[model samples]
Target: MRTYQLYLIDDEFASHYFGKERMVYQLFKDYKEAVGEYKKILEKQIDFILKPIQEIKIHQFISQYLQKNKDFYTNNGLYYLEIGKRSTAKLEIHERCLMLKANGNYEAETIFFEVLRKTESSFIAIDLEHQRCGWLKPIKERKFV
Candidate 1:
């Protein structure tokens, strides 16, 4: 499981630095505490960004905040991997799901995995065929004609 931290970013300060760097006012582990302080800052009309972050390899934390399932983002659903014609689908394993940057392929087979756990970027799934568990993300490139 990954730990989360909230950061208060100063957009005005970052603008001076060419937007490549941001000035963080503070880091808080508690969401409510951060939000409470965030509200206070908001009342002052100051520019800042408050967000909860997990240390994914690439930062993809642009999702709505939910009170429940803070540890891991919950998005329970089925994941389907459709192998293209003359192509393959595969499942790759890593120390963490965030580290996976590519999708796997299997030849001539359509695989369905029941999603046991879901996050913003990846899914913890069990393969129905081999009864194996691994990290997977749903593919959105397929189109139905």
Candidate 2:
């Protein structure tokens, strides 16, 4: 028999070393139940990922998910928050800045990046504005669209 479990992944510290492993939290057996709880939790904060797991390891699952959805967050070439201003960096942002989503409509002070190519600690990201690629720490800000 197979069982399902849900994990609460912290989006804030997702890119730092050991962040993903340490942030995986909560366990639920039902997907719908978990989603319902996640929705309620989202009302209070946007920096949490509620992911459902079957058999795969948490780290593996998150890595695959981020790889698959890399395009969604990179459509507008991604943006770095500078006092709430949408700024594009030719390379990578040096200072810790919030990654903007919803095409800059929404902004959260969380680490968010689209993974083009990945390693254990970082990934290559494309700056569509400059048509250049640079290394960035990968972070999964959301579990779903």
The model with the greatest lDDT is: 2
Estimate, for each residue in 1-145, the C-alpha lDDT of model 1 and write its tens digit: 1111212223333233221222121111122245676766553442233222233422222122222222222233211233343332222222232111113344212221222123332332322223333333333333589
Model 1 segments beyond 4 Å from truth?
5-12, 15-39, 42-145
- Clashing pairs in model 1, backbone N/Cα/C closer than 3 A: 88-105, 88-106, 89-105, 89-106, 90-104, 90-105, 90-106
Candidate 1 TM-score to native:
0.18
Give Cα distance to truth, residue 26, candidate 1, Å. Answer: 1.9
- Across 1-145, the per-residue lDDT of candidate 2 in tens digits comes to 1111112223333344233332222111122245676756643342233212222332343346544432222223332233244422211222212222223322222223332122223332322333333334445544585
Model 2 CA deviation exceeding 4 Å by range: 1-102, 105-110, 114-119, 138-145
TM-score of each: 0.18, 0.20
Alpha carbon lDDT of each predicted model: 0.28, 0.30
Cα distance off (Å), candidate 1, residue 125: 26
